[model samples]
Target: MSEIVIRTASARQGDIARRAEAMGVDDVFISDLVETFYARVQANETLGPVFEAAIGDEWTPHLHTMKQFWSSIALNAGTYGGRPIPAHHKHLDKIKSEHFSIWLALFAQTLHDIAPSPEAAAFFLERAERIGENFQSILFK
Candidate 1:
């Protein structure tokens, strides 16, 4: 593995071991955030179709993956190991700028509705925005 990946994993492992020191985030909060955001995605007219087509009857596995993903992001739990870039790249044809806007909006709202604190919400939102920007650049450029 590259040094960057190795360092990142090491940092994340330390983070997971340290736990509440990062931002007071916990597993339950991440779970709630992922679940609520996905539920909103499922009901959304614009995003629902794309996600449904990609996910279909695999919601259970998807949800589990999402939980792990958010946990990895919010808590650096190292629970998820999948690559998000390639995953999103596979749906590049279905994604658009507006889709990212809607996603960020829903993510922000989910954080507001379920986050443990304002700082936690801001923390996650900042990361989400960065991730969205990166995805947009790759998908559009």
Candidate 2:
């Protein structure tokens, strides 16, 4: 038998996914992000009440869709393709541009806590930034 070697380094990508999955990121990341985001949104003077009212009866389905969205992005699951622009367009009517920033910040912070790699944390935050920018542009522009 040949001698075996063990490495203790983490890859920028693979380890991130592994750590994230172990942290329940694949299964719970999105909902956790959304719940934190919504709490901030609900406490904001400009957007709080709007989300509380308009988001009524839509929590579970919305959370399901968000999980599918995140899994597809983070795991190549291809589980999401819905036109969320329209779904968010309605909410944009009541929110300020700054609301997206708050969402991104909270999302990044949450993922950072659970992410296993800088790359993974960066990947998640970058996606959140992109989504916030895209949604704000399409709806507010």
Candidate 3:
């Protein structure tokens, strides 16, 4: 029955959440990752200008949204509801294809520096790589 299916899905989600928590993937970790990664992005010569052009000086809102986005991806918290493709499309003029690689490198570095465990770092990196690949495929096509 549909009711049973729904319950099963919910239970699976709950189990995943518990596993994430056991690996130290919580709001604090997500916030730290976003903040640290964006800091690197802002400092990078390649990524800094592109991001500055798109974001201007309004970084607080963007950081908050990113925190929500990563939390949703890593924890299944269902916090992010924004349309990422449309949001990125608005800045397509500034976002170069190479920038995704730079972004992923910075993200990996951030995870390496701050992640509580190798497992946690891998978890975020796997999702980040997938997202970067998906965005590139969609945006560049």
* Candidate topping TM-score: 3
Report lDDT per candidate.
0.84, 0.71, 0.91
* Candidate 1 regions with alpha-carbon error over 4 angstroms: 1-24
lDDT of 2 by residue, 26-81 (tens): 65556666566566666776666766677876777767777788877886566898
The ten-residue window of minimal lDDT in model 3 covers 1-10
lDDT of 1 at 15: 63
In candidate 2, stretches whose alpha carbon ends up further than 4 angstroms from where it belongs are: 1-25, 28-47
lDDT of 1 by residue, 1-141 (tens): 656544676786776646544555887777778889999999999999989988889998999998898887766667899888888888867877789999999999998888777888898899999998998898788
Candidate 3 lDDT by residue in tens digits, 57-122: 999999999999988888888889999988998999899898999999999999999999999999
**Residue 4, model 2: Cα distance from true site in angstroms:** 34
- Model 3's alpha-carbon lDDT is 0.91
Query: Which scores higher on TM-score, 1 or 3?
Result: 3
Ranking by TM-score: 3, 1, 2
Q: Which model is ahead, 2 or 3, in terms of lDDT?
A: 3
